[model samples]
Target: MNGEGKVVCVTGGSGYIASWIVKLLLLRGYAVKATVRDPNDQKKTDHLLALDGAKERLQLFKANLLEEGSFEHAIDGCEAVFHTASPVKPFAADPQAELIELAVKGTMNVLETCTKVPSVKRVILTSSIATVFCPKPPLGPNDLIDETVFSDPSVCEENKQWYLLSKTLAEDAARQFAKANKIDLVVINPGFVVGPILQPALNFSVDVIVDFINGKNTFNQRNHRFVDVRDVALAHVKTLETPSASGRYIIVGPATVTTNEIEKVLREFYPDLRIADESEEGTSPLNYKASVAEKVKSLGIELTPAETSLRDTVLSLKEKCLL
Candidate 1:
């Protein structure tokens, strides 16, 4: 359906990617019902309200991913819903249970609410490339994963990899439910999102970038599938409007790069920054170890170069005093 004049509910609207989605929706003349965990948090909603067209088109609602029917009020009268809320943590004590429950249950809850709302036609879910690519080597010299590849939850479960398992199951459940209920669902699976962070609140994912710029030794590995935040957000809006778009769309930048490459660019761009050494032993910042060219090409999206993406991210962080 055309987004103009139709209300769209964006879950986790205060988040990094969701915030951009809200901004674009408002800019495109769509009424937005943004759902956040705490509606009273003026710091979060204030910036959105201050954006152009937000005053007349934006509405904030308090909702929780774990709560049943919490999204019903926000989704009412909306033609589409962007389910971008998911528990994203570096480590979790009960990763499997918490991530799985939140991902699967939260998706079910949102879709359940959509069923009740007659106006709802589409649900754009914010999935990740983690659901498609496994975090291991030997993906072959030229192996690039796409929407057709689904992460083997069994492998993830054996390794106690809760995050991957959670995403896999969540997207799977979303697809199954959408088919049964006849709801049009479009899923965008993005790689390590790198772009200008709009909010001052740093997410867990951004911490890695911060560490890289600070010259932390723990992240010198050369493995990751990076994507620009703007591209991911733009893909979300495009998928929502594109009639031919269906199923999963893997949104990633041109190609993968190592942490060493990332650090070199940062050091070159900002010479004064505390750059990390390659000798330092630490976890790799690169999340998805696969290619996303096919999925992006299918959507006719041209990914931003890794150099440009990293440069923009560092510049943005410097401007915000995050560096």
Candidate 2:
């Protein structure tokens, strides 16, 4: 069969990133069987169903991230399986119960199921940049934040960076499982992802942009590399198509921005936004790095600039009446 005719399964199909992956897969003429927690929820699954090729190419399955073998039926007869489901809340009521345990269990469940699926040749895992570095790391000029670096698990619990801990441990577990069971695995570690909202519900990353424009952020002090959600979606598809794409790839934009820069950019497009002026809040002094050249060259992908990412985000939010 041709590349476009292959069947692929994407876990957590209703999620922010997963939703876009499902859309692109169907657009590429690949049959998609998407797993969601509740396929019957029109509020959650309607956007995916409304896609152009969804009627003929997309299938929805009721699956749970923590349920063992829940993904097998959806993944059956697929050449590739994309595992994008994970706990992403920055602050959890109970760190272990809400984030840590679920992340590891979900990763294990998906990888185990892949082992049993002989038809699955490749597994693309949607991990985050949180796995590559501590949530709060000491940065210096030219100190690279790339695939080679890993988060320090020892301090995440104390620092309240449970999200990082969850991703780091889960990715480590996946690598080990793939080695032992002989499963082909590739990891995509994307930075603070922001872009047009394709789903009915807002993702945590885009929610920050909404809050920024609406004057919800009272104080700001953090640095991040923003990547377009659309670009990230394409990256996942490219990884699946490229035969040489293996190991972990860090997906991110070209700029490192502070909260003030974000506000200024948003204000450029949304003059009526209530975002507070942080002119006095000088830009963060840290020169944090994201080593993306190698990955971009390898994938032959062009990244959208920060302005495009933020601009489309605001437009999408307004279009969706989210703002």
Candidate 3:
């Protein structure tokens, strides 16, 4: 096993992506100290506790992102820290305070705790593609975005794109803190992550697929960049295990997809479901833009196929009675 009985801590362990990370960590022979908002809440932590090696290796800790020193105990004596806890609330009355400030403060708190914990060797911060490209540049049809491109805070703030603003600022804060403190930090920036979710609740990304299946008219964007949740989780683990892995890696499918592509696959597999038609809204022609960076290729992470990801997502939703 690659983990070799090492100890690591994962913040926001119950989240859709974090839970899968915990599962993979355990399977690879690592003892995991996972943090949740409330340890006593079985609803949130139960899935984590039921992993293959949970009884022997997994420990749940209560921690908060905004509260300073909250992650100290959870991060103490750990080999690495996977700081995946970030606020996903998109519709908040105070975007600055609720989303932006909270995301930045939470990241700082985790990094501060890592500095206090001497055993912490590397920090794998989960970032998003929102930080890679800005809405202002208005991606040209021929443009290919990579890790070098950064989201402009001014652009995000001016447009009231609070979610992107939060991710952008939070990632910047993590990089600055890690550099000043001499911590080995590697960031995984994933795109439109959608796969069989390990967590019980429906995440915003998965909900996008759910809404489409239920015939709800959502999603302003025409092209949806999809990546498997498992692939994203594997990228995090691989980045930590591979000593040479550094900097940001964009984890997404090789090609971008649209709702029509997704709908076609869904309808082919599931004829009974009521899938939304893109023609209903008179969507533009299929513009499969949004390419990923070459950094992910260096990690040796083969992304899952879009059709396989979509099928597994719906199947998992059905199993959980959430579809």
* Model 1 pairs whose backbones collide: 215-275, 215-276, 218-282, 222-258
* Colliding residue pairs in candidate 2: none
Best by TM-score: 3
Model 1 TM-score relative to the real fold? 0.90
lDDT of 1 by residue, 29-101 (tens): 8999999988888877777788788888899999988899999999999988999988887578988566889
User: Which scores greater on lDDT, model 2 or model 3?
Assistant: 3
- Evaluate candidate 2 by giving its C-alpha RMSD to the native, one decimal: 2.7
Clashing pairs in 3: none
Of 1 and 2, the candidate ahead on TM-score is 2
What's the lDDT for residue 244 in model 2? 89
Instruction: Give the alpha carbon lDDT tens digit for every residue of 75-158 in model 2.
Output: 889999999988788878898889988889998998899888899999999998777666346545677766777777875656
Cα lDDT of candidate 3 equals: 0.85
Q: For residues 76-144, could you state the per-residue lDDT of candidate 3 as single tens digits?
A: 889999999998855689998888888999999999889888899999999998787674565556767
C-alpha lDDT of candidate 2 relative to the true structure: 0.83
- Winner on lDDT between 1 and 2 is 2
CA lDDT of every candidate: 0.80, 0.83, 0.85
